[model samples]
Target: MQAWQGIDEFVSVVEQGSFTKAGQQLQVSTAHVSRSINALEKRLAVKLLHRSTRQVSTTATGQIYYQQCRQLLDGLLDANRTVNQLNTTPSGLIKITAPIYYGERIIAPLFNRLLQQYPDIELDLQLSNHNVELISEGFDLAIRLGSLADSSLMARRIGSRHFDVVASKSYFARCGQPHTIDELNQHNCLRGISDHWHFDVDGRRKDLRIHGSWRCNSGLAVARAAMDGIGIAQLPHYYTDNAVEDGRLMRVLEQHRPHSEGIWAVYPQNRHLSTKLRVVIDFLAAELGEQR
Candidate 1:
């Protein structure tokens, strides 16, 4: 604890550029801050900062020490924020981003429900298909599906995404059914995978390069194309849940149905997460789990 106090004083002096300013900010006398830093230097046996008339400068060793000390202090401050947030009501605008199709069909409803339950919470939702940086773009959270490319963010799995290749009943009636992965090459495919399809066989994953004239970036568009007898499309279970149940679309190569990945609520890596974000994440996990 005494070491921490010493570190605090040292960091304050460096940031404020003067012992007097640092002492004022810490609500202590200049002499006390100087004494704390001196004690720290004696304990560490290293000169941390070079003092001058106008400002204090850090040596290479000081830079390293400052970084470590800043990390510790920031961690402590973050913990305090978390504790305070737990006791405080969540009433701030939380910015969230999600893919377009999922945002409209899945995320939007859940977000609306959250908003209803916590009227104090304000939501700024961005619906797009492009991947964006969570920290640099300043999003509080993001709902992502499939594989996570960036390992830096923290991800909490909310649900599983099951995928199947399907075509409209009319399309199947014309081109026939595909019983094997190889048979898919004989028919017109919707080609949503950027000219490829993934499959699972005997507990192993496989990627099969596919070809088609109709290419689409939108899942809904691909589904719509398949429904119009344009081609077969590989789509997530949620996208074709109602249609598949209603016999609007027919599933093909059931054994080749791709392995289900997870749905995740992701956020930037933080030493401590806010209460509002944690509650919402837990709520989403619980709600989506129940839905499954």
Candidate 2:
């Protein structure tokens, strides 16, 4: 009897909570998956699972058994993945998560280049501003801006960002440009809640709040406001670099620029780093470094 095969089937069924999903994932028929689990129970001489029409739950004995078996199975799978990665090259789906605008503007192009280098890798990008748990979400890695609050994660600093005080040429022509940071109080500003511009002149990092007619949560919207000559917006270099280079917006307070905030690639603290994740992180750090 293939004990490991039966164990694998049992673990899959319990994890998927349904015979059908487990079968599909394992590429076996539902009847076959059921049979495998039944066979496992008979061999173990104990009931391993409680099954209902909607879902499958592990019994106390099953739960303990599952935990022990899961570790063994995962170790075996990790060894296989490691060996395969060493024998071959990096391939398969690599799921990455990053901020929406940052990913589209910065990371996407890098990924395009990476794909050219490794044609075998299938890149899956999920863009969102909300923080996602890398392990729980099944993401290979996550890109984060500023300092991370979670100590459980292992973070590698990739790059840094400087704030740009910007306004459209049209707006500047009407409201006049602020020669000093203090003058920004009198001008219209487009504010994004998530983006709080802070500055450290001689080692004091403090918030530089500016009043605005329009307040938004989206960074792109704030950029659009500045593009349309709505108001002066203090945005990150990532958002304003293209606009500044294109002459659509003018940067102010060049001398009083804030200290650069850090960019990080974060992952769960693990004893072993997967090859796919390690390669991707190194690739992105190089890519973002080029932008600096």
Candidate 3:
């Protein structure tokens, strides 16, 4: 407590750049601020500030001390906030957005569980494939998958998604299994939202352009086409995992399967995350990670 004597006054003076302004901010007189800092300098045996009638500035030693003191003060403030928040029950509506299929298959159910657990907390979840403007649209958060485009939004990885190139057993039996990446050109490759399929080739990622008579933007439709032996399809593990296990579909080019991509919870960088939002994000991260 003794060592903490003049820290507040010194930090405030450095930040405000004037003893008078620092006194105003701390609700003390300018003479009091000046006396406290002088006593601190004598105790430390160091010159902390260069002062004049018109201006005040930190000494080299004072700059270093200010940085460290600022961090300590910030930590103290955060700790106080945490204690206060713990006593406050979270009760508010949180607006969120997520991809359509993932929202239906994954996020929605978890949110249902969350609602059941925290009766006071409400949710408005919007399911869409389009990347909506979170700030402009007034959304609290967004769940994004795969490689994220560069943006200012803050992101936390909740889980991962793996892609599988798969087709029905009957289709493999008729067309024969393709052993290598180049052989994909000869086989009828089903197209989805993207014309290119990702793979890890010789320890590096390679996007192979694929063509086939069958093309659909919907992953479900493309999966159905593959099951019907229309063509081979590339889809996320969630879409094809059950079918592959049940012998409805068989994975191909297993060795070349691309590395998993992160599933992220994205939110505006400047948004103040409330207790409800933090609880929801933590729940989603835990559940989604376990499912993966």
Which candidate order results from sorting by TM-score in descending order? 3, 1, 2
Where does candidate 3 have its weakest 10-residue lDDT segment? 270-279
TM-score per candidate, chains pooled: 0.75, 0.68, 0.88
Whole-model Cα lDDT of every candidate shown, in order: 0.87, 0.86, 0.92
- 184-241, model 2: which lDDT tens digit per residue? 8899978898435665566676676778779888888899899999998988888888
Q: For every candidate structure, what is the RMSD over all alpha carbons to the true structure, in angstroms?
A: 4.0, 10.0, 2.5
**Model 1 spans with C-alpha error above 4 angstroms:** 1-5, 38-67, 131-140, 147-157, 168-176, 209-218, 224-231, 262-275, 289-292
**Quick one: ranking by lDDT, best first?**
3, 1, 2
Residue 174 CA displacement from its true place in model 2, Å = 1.2
lDDT tens digits, residues 15-107, model 1? 998999999999999999999998999899999999888779898999999999999888888878877988988788899999998889988
Predicted model with the maximum TM-score: 3
Clashing pairs in 1: none
For 63-140, candidate 3 gives per-residue lDDT tens digits of 998999999998888888877777888889999999998899888999999899999998999999999999999999
C-alpha RMSD (angstroms) for model 3: 2.5
